[model samples]
Target: MIAVMLEILGSALLGLGLAAAAAVLLAHRLPARRLVLLAGGIGALLGAYVTHEALGPGHVLVTLLGSLGVSAVVVSLLLRPAAQAAAPAPAHRAVP
Candidate 1:
Protein backbone atom coordinates (compact mmCIF):
# COMPACT_ATOMS: atom_id res chain seq x y z
CA MET A 1 0.00 0.00 0.00
CA ILE A 2 2.71 2.46 0.99
CA ALA A 3 4.74 1.46 -2.02
CA VAL A 4 1.80 2.11 -4.27
CA MET A 5 1.29 5.55 -2.79
CA LEU A 6 4.96 6.40 -3.13
CA GLU A 7 4.99 5.18 -6.68
CA ILE A 8 2.07 7.42 -7.54
CA LEU A 9 3.66 10.43 -5.90
CA GLY A 10 7.02 9.86 -7.51
CA SER A 11 5.49 9.27 -10.89
CA ALA A 12 3.42 12.41 -10.69
CA LEU A 13 6.46 14.49 -9.79
CA LEU A 14 8.47 13.02 -12.62
CA GLY A 15 5.69 13.66 -15.07
CA LEU A 16 5.27 17.26 -14.00
CA GLY A 17 9.00 17.82 -14.22
CA LEU A 18 9.14 16.35 -17.68
CA ALA A 19 6.20 18.44 -18.77
CA ALA A 20 7.72 21.62 -17.42
CA ALA A 21 11.00 20.98 -19.16
CA ALA A 22 9.23 20.27 -22.43
CA ALA A 23 7.14 23.36 -22.08
CA VAL A 24 10.24 25.44 -21.62
CA LEU A 25 12.32 23.77 -24.30
CA LEU A 26 9.56 23.16 -26.81
CA ALA A 27 7.27 25.99 -26.03
CA HIS A 28 6.68 26.83 -29.67
CA ARG A 29 6.03 23.22 -30.62
CA LEU A 30 3.65 22.47 -27.77
CA PRO A 31 0.10 23.56 -27.08
CA ALA A 32 -1.12 25.61 -24.17
CA ARG A 33 0.84 25.37 -20.91
CA ARG A 34 -2.15 24.22 -18.91
CA LEU A 35 -2.98 21.45 -21.35
CA VAL A 36 0.56 20.19 -21.45
CA LEU A 37 0.81 20.14 -17.67
CA LEU A 38 -2.53 18.41 -17.28
CA ALA A 39 -1.73 15.78 -19.86
CA GLY A 40 1.67 15.12 -18.36
CA GLY A 41 0.31 14.63 -14.86
CA ILE A 42 -2.62 12.48 -15.88
CA GLY A 43 -0.63 10.44 -18.35
CA ALA A 44 2.05 9.63 -15.79
CA LEU A 45 -0.51 8.72 -13.17
CA LEU A 46 -2.27 6.35 -15.52
CA GLY A 47 1.02 4.93 -16.72
CA ALA A 48 2.12 4.22 -13.18
CA TYR A 49 -1.18 2.60 -12.36
CA VAL A 50 -1.09 0.42 -15.45
CA THR A 51 2.54 -0.55 -14.95
CA HIS A 52 2.01 -1.35 -11.31
CA GLU A 53 -0.99 -3.49 -12.09
CA ALA A 54 0.79 -5.35 -14.83
CA LEU A 55 4.09 -5.89 -13.01
CA GLY A 56 2.55 -5.95 -9.57
CA PRO A 57 4.25 -4.48 -6.49
CA GLY A 58 7.99 -4.64 -5.70
CA HIS A 59 8.78 -2.83 -8.92
CA VAL A 60 8.41 0.77 -7.95
CA LEU A 61 11.50 1.92 -9.82
CA VAL A 62 10.43 0.22 -13.00
CA THR A 63 6.91 1.53 -12.63
CA LEU A 64 8.11 5.10 -12.17
CA LEU A 65 10.35 4.81 -15.20
CA GLY A 66 7.46 3.48 -17.23
CA SER A 67 5.32 6.33 -16.05
CA LEU A 68 7.97 8.82 -17.08
CA GLY A 69 8.31 7.23 -20.47
CA VAL A 70 4.58 7.23 -21.00
CA SER A 71 4.29 10.84 -19.93
CA ALA A 72 7.06 11.88 -22.33
CA VAL A 73 5.40 10.05 -25.19
CA VAL A 74 2.06 11.57 -24.43
CA VAL A 75 3.54 15.07 -24.26
CA SER A 76 5.55 14.55 -27.41
CA LEU A 77 2.41 13.55 -29.28
CA LEU A 78 0.99 16.98 -28.56
CA LEU A 79 3.87 18.77 -30.24
CA ARG A 80 3.18 20.85 -33.33
CA PRO A 81 5.33 22.52 -35.90
CA ALA A 82 5.90 26.24 -35.72
CA ALA A 83 3.20 28.31 -37.34
CA GLN A 84 3.88 29.71 -40.78
CA ALA A 85 3.32 33.34 -41.61
CA ALA A 86 0.26 34.13 -43.74
CA ALA A 87 0.74 35.70 -47.12
CA PRO A 88 -0.57 39.21 -47.68
CA ALA A 89 -3.66 39.67 -49.79
CA PRO A 90 -3.41 41.46 -53.14
CA ALA A 91 -4.91 44.91 -53.50
CA HIS A 92 -8.24 45.10 -55.36
CA ARG A 93 -8.62 47.44 -58.40
CA ALA A 94 -11.82 49.40 -59.17
CA VAL A 95 -13.67 48.39 -62.33
CA PRO A 96 -13.93 50.98 -65.05
Candidate 2:
Protein backbone atom coordinates (compact mmCIF):
# COMPACT_ATOMS: atom_id res chain seq x y z
CA MET A 1 0.00 0.00 0.00
CA ILE A 2 1.11 3.53 -0.68
CA ALA A 3 0.49 4.50 2.90
CA VAL A 4 2.74 1.76 4.25
CA MET A 5 5.46 2.60 1.80
CA LEU A 6 5.30 6.25 2.69
CA GLU A 7 5.45 5.46 6.38
CA ILE A 8 8.45 3.25 5.92
CA LEU A 9 10.23 5.84 3.83
CA GLY A 10 9.55 8.49 6.39
CA SER A 11 10.82 6.37 9.24
CA ALA A 12 13.90 5.34 7.31
CA LEU A 13 14.79 8.93 6.57
CA LEU A 14 14.27 9.91 10.18
CA GLY A 15 16.40 7.05 11.39
CA LEU A 16 19.22 7.94 9.03
CA GLY A 17 19.13 11.58 9.93
CA LEU A 18 19.09 10.94 13.67
CA ALA A 19 21.88 8.39 13.40
CA ALA A 20 24.06 10.72 11.36
CA ALA A 21 23.49 13.52 13.81
CA ALA A 22 24.32 11.28 16.76
CA ALA A 23 27.49 9.98 15.17
CA VAL A 24 28.64 13.46 14.23
CA LEU A 25 28.05 14.69 17.76
CA LEU A 26 29.81 11.68 19.25
CA ALA A 27 32.74 12.00 16.88
CA HIS A 28 33.33 15.46 18.28
CA ARG A 29 33.90 13.93 21.71
CA LEU A 30 34.96 10.34 21.16
CA PRO A 31 38.37 9.61 19.74
CA ALA A 32 37.20 6.30 18.21
CA ARG A 33 35.44 7.21 15.00
CA ARG A 34 34.75 3.58 14.24
CA LEU A 35 33.06 2.98 17.58
CA VAL A 36 30.81 6.01 17.21
CA LEU A 37 29.87 4.95 13.72
CA LEU A 38 29.18 1.45 14.94
CA ALA A 39 26.93 2.79 17.68
CA GLY A 40 25.03 5.01 15.29
CA GLY A 41 24.56 2.27 12.71
CA ILE A 42 23.28 -0.14 15.30
CA GLY A 43 20.89 2.47 16.65
CA ALA A 44 19.52 3.26 13.20
CA LEU A 45 19.08 -0.36 12.28
CA LEU A 46 17.24 -1.05 15.53
CA GLY A 47 15.06 2.01 15.15
CA ALA A 48 14.05 0.98 11.66
CA TYR A 49 13.30 -2.53 12.77
CA VAL A 50 11.18 -1.32 15.67
CA THR A 51 9.27 1.05 13.44
CA HIS A 52 8.54 -1.66 10.90
CA GLU A 53 7.52 -4.17 13.51
CA ALA A 54 5.22 -1.68 15.17
CA LEU A 55 3.57 -0.78 11.86
CA GLY A 56 3.14 -4.41 10.74
CA PRO A 57 1.43 -7.36 12.33
CA GLY A 58 4.00 -9.46 14.13
CA HIS A 59 4.23 -11.86 17.06
CA VAL A 60 5.28 -10.70 20.50
CA LEU A 61 8.30 -12.98 20.65
CA VAL A 62 9.58 -11.70 17.33
CA THR A 63 9.42 -8.12 18.52
CA LEU A 64 11.03 -8.97 21.82
CA LEU A 65 13.82 -10.90 20.14
CA GLY A 66 14.45 -8.11 17.70
CA SER A 67 14.63 -5.58 20.51
CA LEU A 68 16.83 -7.86 22.58
CA GLY A 69 19.16 -8.42 19.66
CA VAL A 70 19.51 -4.70 19.18
CA SER A 71 20.22 -4.15 22.85
CA ALA A 72 22.83 -6.90 22.86
CA VAL A 73 24.58 -5.48 19.82
CA VAL A 74 24.71 -1.97 21.31
CA VAL A 75 25.73 -3.05 24.82
CA SER A 76 28.45 -5.37 23.56
CA LEU A 77 29.89 -2.83 21.20
CA LEU A 78 30.01 -0.16 23.88
CA LEU A 79 31.07 -2.18 26.91
CA ARG A 80 33.21 -5.04 25.65
CA PRO A 81 35.92 -2.88 24.16
CA ALA A 82 36.12 -0.71 27.23
CA ALA A 83 36.34 -3.78 29.46
CA GLN A 84 39.15 -5.19 27.37
CA ALA A 85 40.98 -1.90 27.42
CA ALA A 86 40.57 -1.56 31.16
CA ALA A 87 42.04 -4.91 32.13
CA PRO A 88 45.63 -4.68 33.29
CA ALA A 89 48.27 -6.71 31.51
CA PRO A 90 50.01 -9.38 33.54
CA ALA A 91 53.59 -8.66 34.48
CA HIS A 92 56.26 -10.83 32.89
CA ARG A 93 57.58 -13.46 35.34
CA ALA A 94 61.11 -14.91 35.05
CA VAL A 95 61.25 -18.70 34.78
CA PRO A 96 63.21 -20.40 37.65
Question: Which numbered prediction scores highest in lDDT against the true structure?
Answer: 1
Which 10 consecutive positions of candidate 1 have the poorest summed lDDT?
81-90
How many residue pairs clash (N, CA or C atoms closer than 3 angstroms) in each of the candidate models, in the order given? 0, 0
lDDT for predicted candidate 1 compared with the true structure: 0.94
**Which lDDT values do the candidates have, in the order given?**
0.94, 0.50
Q: Which candidate leads in TM-score? A: 1
C-alpha lDDT of candidate 2 relative to the true structure = 0.50
Candidate 2 lDDT tens digits, 28-81: 444465655555455545754784567564343344344445534453454322
Q: Write the per-residue lDDT of candidate 1 for residues 25-49, one digit (tens) a residue.
A: 9998999999999999988998999
Residue 71's lDDT within candidate 1 is 98
Candidate 2 matches the true fold with a TM-score of: 0.38
